[model samples]
Target chain A: EERPPPRGLTAPTVAAGAIAKKWLAEHFGVKIRGYMSQLGPIVIPFQSWDEVENNPFYAPNADVVPELEAYMDALRKDGDSIGARIEVIAENVPAGLGEPIYARIDAEIAYAMMGLNAVKGVEIGAGFESVSQRGSEHGDALTPDGFESNHAGGILGGISTGQNIEVSLAIKPTSSIRIKRPSINQAGEPVEVQTLGRHDPCVGIRATPIAESLLAIVIMDQLLRQRAQCGSDWLETKEQE
Target chain B: EERPPPRGLTAPTVAAGAIAKKWLAEHFGVKIRGYMSQLGPIVIPFQSWDEVENNPFYAPNADVVPELEAYMDALRKDGDSIGARIEVIAENVPAGLGEPIYARIDAEIAYAMMGLNAVKGVEIGAGFESVSQRGSEHGDALTPDGFESNHAGGILGGISTGQNIEVSLAIKPTSSIRIKRPSINQAGEPVEVQTLGRHDPCVGIRATPIAESLLAIVIMDQLLRQRAQCGSDWLETKEQE
Candidate 1:
């Protein structure tokens, strides 16, 4: 018998929403607030992916705290998924901390964001929208009053322009579902399984703070590297003899 | 007969200086600057050690554009050598780009320096000298205006503290000598051969710019990454509204 190629089928959003609502009422209502209150805003500290995979619980999602637990529970009961937006803001960055040829800043950032669990895509300040604007319109104009705007996202020549940088990520829906699916089991045997577990319908809810933590570690590593060379500019100051 | 390990012997500074001076006049002085200037500083961008073996010119001592005619003339003369000190300086850098962590900026800088060919050691912001200072004296105190002092070398917690980064290196004398020496050839046959080509008596003379170029790259990378995660902290109230 000939097998059909993979078909393009979208997940049933309404059905998923109803299931989510039931799951939230049955398991999440009481626990969500407690967990949220205990953790509040979360920050992942590990830089390497090995460290993160070794202990996923160490960096829990910030939105899962008490302040937002009720809403999350309600969301679960409604069978509708909610999205989380996190901003990893940093200050006091030094200039000249990136490689030119292959290890450019943009390349590293993109890799880091993609590494997050549910991050579908990343944008560095008005990213895709820039394509619609003219060069003069999109270019971050230099001005005596500082940059006219932040279209360049605080980077020039792949180096820090001493301005605040901004990035946003769009997370996708979680893959796990309670509904039955045709899938190959561990032995490559055909099997029918309905996933049953405590999980977010949208995994992106946990990705926000994790992105912030990785950025911190990368920045710290690069700063030390910069200081190792040419950190000094003035020496023989005319020896005021 | 079993050969005994060589005994440690100290040569007189005068003798060392004389040998160094003679070598500098005979070999390095002939065209060291010409080689370095043409190459435009010494940082080698390579993926791995295998790539390095594939390309010998990557070694700090290897010259890209050799003054062949002048070098041959010097090689024809009796044994001679030379040495030089190349200094690099980066000016107008902001403070507070690094943190004290597994990825300290100073440590990374040292690693880069050691990564270079024949580089013995690296130092940062009066490096080892700070070890002798008291806490009150060594610490960079913050003033309402700025810093009253900067003994910490513009760093704290492996992160930059918004100050000028400073670093230096000690370049070693080149190992290849014109005088005959015992060595094993590719066939594992022991033989004596005077190096026929002209090489830098000391490689440090061309190190300054290479170090600067790498430092620039690392700093720029970190700054951009930091901005992406944390630069949005300063978002205006209008956006919040």
Candidate 2:
């Protein structure tokens, strides 16, 4: 479909990964979902998965419905470029799945997400915020009813805490905007150029599926690693190769 | 070395890897350094390699002389639990050293760091701070001065941009604190027990060298990956493998 994406203006070629993720999720029994938490400077309050499913903008909630329409109107009015911050959730990841220190869960997740074309940042739960916290404040206290807090973002000592894995990624503004900008060509002479190609206004708008796919890939890799490190119990159904 | 570590007590097993790292760095141009950035609530600002060399508290810097002495005195006085934040720097990393998505550099680094015991969080350069910055502010502008800024922490789209790679790791307090704490034995008996074993007070005290070693392993893995992906021009003197 050549039409503007129902979620955002990203090229369909990129967003197309969602279809594959949908199929993989069914086979894996892992639910992966992503939604825009922020668009440009327009921030949206977080919504549960139930609420996120209905958003036409593919945002996590309807909290920004009016703001979204107004922003879209303003974009059309002033022809400005925008960016998005996407949050992805991966549920049902088994604990004891990641390798320690060298092949870790958080490290793997960060690597996968940052590898995306426009992702400028990746945070697991309260990632960077923890830098400002004290050791006592940041450490998750354990209780009989599970962890009192998930400040560790479902990961502890680099292994899955059996809590849902949450990752937020920052997708930078598309550099392919039509605005004319100065650049040096191959011979190094400065020239003003306007980009022309398949582009997305905010590529993150359509990135949910892609995020899911990447998470799936990481999860799958970890699953195999878990089998190798922890034993092959999870791979009981696998045909001997 | 048989004595309990002055900070978070730890087994000496981890610190042994640094000896090998020192030898490895001599052969390769890449040099890895790690030291305590935070001890409990005390924060030591980043220091240059020259300043960091003479620290007695395992910091790379001699800058925290007064603070280090006072902190050590207090640790000896109260004998309370504490943790450390370690920052590891990898210098002279070649660009394009990581896979675009699946086998990314940041992911590899994070995995290596997080896999270590007691590491609570990991950051790359201005890691989590970018969460609040604007797109215009966060995006590193291209210049003849290379990347102009390394807010991306030497990685872009999962590949090294030929910058010094910086990693910050938050190491949790050692679990074997001398404090009398409550825990359930395997028989489900609630018991107040004191851990008796060889332990460091703050495991991070000895971790600088260990962190250095882990970083070495990751760099070597990525270096081999780089050679495999980009071929042997980078490894001009490799023995047949």
lDDT of each: 0.41, 0.64
Give lDDT tens digits, candidate 2, residues B191-213: 55565455555667766776777
Chain A vs. true chain A, TM-score per model, equals: 0.60, 0.81
A1-241 in candidate 1: lDDT tens per residue? Answer: 2233222111332244334334333431211110000111223232443332232232234332344556446546644443333334344344455664334454455445434433333445544343233222444544444556765554443565556555545443343444444445566566554455565644544554455555554554444455555453311111111
lDDT of 1 by residue, B117-185 (tens): 433333445343332232223344454445566544454445665565655444443435465645445
**Number of clashing residue pairs, candidate 2:** 21
Number of the predicted model whose lDDT against the real structure is largest:
2
- The TM-scores, one per candidate, come to 0.34, 0.72
Docking class of 2: incorrect
Residue A129 CA displacement from its true place in model 2, Å: 4.3
Minimum summed lDDT over a 10-residue window in model 2 chain B is located at: B1-10
What DockQ number belongs to candidate 2? Answer: 0.22
Interface RMSD of 2: 4.8
